[model samples]
Target: MSRATVHFLLRSDLERLFTTLTDNQYEIIGPTVKDGAVLYTPIQHSEQLPQGWQQLQAPGAYRMTRDNSQRYFAWANGPQALKPWLFAPREIIWQAERQPDGSLQFSEPAQPDRKLAFIGLRNCDLAALKLQDQHFLQGQYRDPYYAARRKGLLLIAVNCSHPADTCFCASTGDGPHAKADSEQPGFDLCLTELDDGFLVQSGSEPGDQLLEQLPVSPTTENQLHQQLQQALQAAKQQRALPSLPIKDLLAERRDHPQWDDIAERCLACGNCTQVCPTCFCHAEGEQVSLNSAVSEHTREWASCFSEGHGYMAGHQARPGIRERYQQWMTHKLSYWHDQYGRSGCTGCGRCTTWCPAAIDFPLEVSRICGDDE
Candidate 1:
């Protein structure tokens, strides 16, 4: 439909699009080859992308190769997601200065620049964003820091042109394509890369506004069909992950042996939770002036896998490594939906890829559910 849909040839017109975006003073963040890994980084132009390059990844393994395809998103999910930029690694709470009179003055942390436009966002990441919005934005106690950084940011989602070995987004019912419509718009612009071109559509008012600047033609019937075909093709290649009724499974496996096995290999490390886009858990701390004149509170990212995360009143609730892992998994895969009306895990596969033990989640589920007998 010409009303809001448009198409552009991927090879010829994509660079122009990037140039147009930069012209608007938007800091474009996209995939680039850095230190032999596909990292989401800043790019001055489209030349910085992994042209004719793609990555094949699985638990404990990630490799790059030339695909001979110029698709901007030919590769699957990368190691680092888009969360680090949006949700900072660390932020100063407030700075305080003491005066000669022993009085102290405090200043709040600086907010993020408002003109960042994220490109190559996947469906799983989008779902993760939704989960974070529920926790940080819609909650009774809104996080002013997160709220300020999240506002006025532009989302440029790309449909998965290739599904990775570790991905199970379809099992989570969030994958390959952006499913939300006008009332529930998830992105500003959705790009589906075709063999020679891209199928572009605007999902929100801002998206429509952005689209007007690019040289996009009305989406023809054939392009629409091609878009569906590409999506279905990616979907068909998805590995069949078992649909474990998470709530029931978790309820029965409170003391399962899998916890012990996982702990033995897990290192009690929090890499999975840290890399996860949907993880919103954090802990707060305070710093006081030397003269006790002023105090400033700070919030830092926390994880369930950490030794001190469950600590309360000098006693940690889940002491054992097994117990902590169980709690994290149970909350993420099962109880999170009940508490927040959405699943905590977005099937982004960053957990498996980044874990030292190469912990395959689907394999874990299979172990818990038992194999075909």
Candidate 2:
């Protein structure tokens, strides 16, 4: 219906897509079955995708089941997406060495990142990727590391037909369909998986060129009928974040009793921050050789729950779990709006899924900030 190029790839010819990326020298990463769950891993062949398997997710529960339907990308998402690849969990930003005269020599990592093709990307993660780009690539100071990795990256998004119970991107307006704009933050190509084939829409020049080489067919009206409805259907969620100005509400309730109740249940294990696609808090340190001759400046992911992360110049800003929880929630839901023009959460619900405390985040937010204003 739109001006985007649409094509159909039969179930048997899925391998052509892999071959195209490989020929273009892009390393393929896709969802695979690992350790009883679906995870992103190196996928060279089409057979490596977790076909017919769907992952069921809740606030703190997860299970994988096989439907034997031979469909690829039948799941919503894994614990993490797109973040780790662009933003390394641990990396050496620059290294210093002691010279012969006891002077210091510094050097930054110069290796260019390999081109990457991410298959089965979800729309919620796509939204988060745009936010990450805003943080790293669009500001006064640009991060060379994130910029280098994102330069040659190719995104092959998948529309959700079997989203997890934890998924709430429908309410966030970031999921169930991938945007097809080449001049904007959109996918290179988006695929909607059906029983016998995939409905593919090309969104960029590289994606369009790739489609021209593949053995795809002009989709028929019959093929476009009921087969793709589930993917197009707005995915419903059991939980929803209150659609109001959460900033003033959270500012008003900074010391509310609800904070105490949440602190009692929150383990402050940093699980939520670790899995959060948009959280950018990190700690940098200098690693030195035992002889103190050579040193390397490195940065690693850090969470607000960490006591050290709360340490300010003279004292700790957030000394207790209550304050830490409040800070995380407020920053994610409120501060992000002030900073990014949108909430930090894309509503993928990974923070709730991987939380060991079994904390339902949206429910907690509602209890604390939902209409009793």
Candidate 3:
């Protein structure tokens, strides 16, 4: 394929090309700050990044100030999401040791201690990592620990140029700018932070071998139309609402009375699908043995607003709290776009800033789609 042209690195050669890609072992990841928020860990240099920080979300706040500006896509969506370090809220997947003559060995759970690169990544977190690469790596049930951390990761994307006031990603088409044909070619360097430096591109083949190992330059069709007119006027001044056919209003809000007046200020509290960067749901457990020898089988991160994720056999399938907040806001604004054709809300509002009751999904979707004025 062709489109990979714009390139230019200087921000001190993109911090010596990410400290020589973290001295070649890769693991980098990015955005920092911790505890008082901002997250997306694993940094080890560039002075543990986040210098001067810049968070500031809304609807049930999240602050963090200062922005001395080393520009990395300034700020927006935080409260930690990038989906629990690529889909992991807990894991163990295998272990069964027993034996002294009874026999039971098992094993199987090592791979993944970091090889990634990540960095800055946004654009509704690369459209929620292509919706968890279509539910656990091209679905049909495959998930080998998210396909070995999605094949030892690399993506570097970034391109958001700020948009948060509960951003709407221009109404779910996905993001305040990041489209040069995205589709899980999980970027191997895509940056944008314009104004004078990074507009790099490359997509695969290890982002053309990490752009033949950086220090790149060539980009002048008026600096690639001024970084695509500052990522389309910062996604048209960060558009906020008006777009909710949410797959035909989640196939006509199954018995909607505004889900019982938004379930009395909803608090089934799955902190908006755990700060959804595209919730993938999870849960599994087992950790036996004390001399029967050993046992372990794990998986965490789950919630249709918890309640034993609908326990079973004796019943629990959505038993109030307004039916698990109307099945997680109608499977995220409508049957997750009728079972994933898209629109599972990448409007990165970090679910109204970690919803402690700021429950404002665009003012409950304009009180059930009606007042967009």
Using lDDT as the yardstick, the better of models 1 and 2 is 2
* Candidates 1 and 2 compared by TM-score, better number: 2
150-209, model 3: which lDDT tens digit per residue? 776887877776676767786666767667675544567787876667878877777777
lDDT of 2 by residue, 50-136 (tens): 888888798888888897778888888888889998899999999999999999999998957688999999999999999999999
lDDT of 1 by residue, 257-373 (tens): 787788888877788778888887777778776776667777777888887888889998988888888887778878897889866887777787777888887677667766431
Report, for all candidates in order, the number of backbone clashes. 0, 0, 0
Stretches of candidate 2 exceeding 4 Å from the true structure? 1-3, 181-185, 232-234
- Higher-ranked by lDDT: 1 or 3: 1
Ranking by lDDT: 2, 1, 3
Q: By TM-score, is 2 or 3 better?
A: 2
Candidate closest to the true structure, highest TM-score: 2
Cα misplacement distance, residue 80 of candidate 3 (Å): 17
Error of 1 at 40 (Å): 2.1
Q: What is the TM-score of each candidate against the true structure?
A: 0.91, 0.95, 0.41
lDDT of each: 0.77, 0.85, 0.74
When summed lDDT is taken over every stretch of 10 residues in candidate 2, the lowest stretch is 226-235
lDDT of 2: 0.85
lDDT of 1 at 278: 85
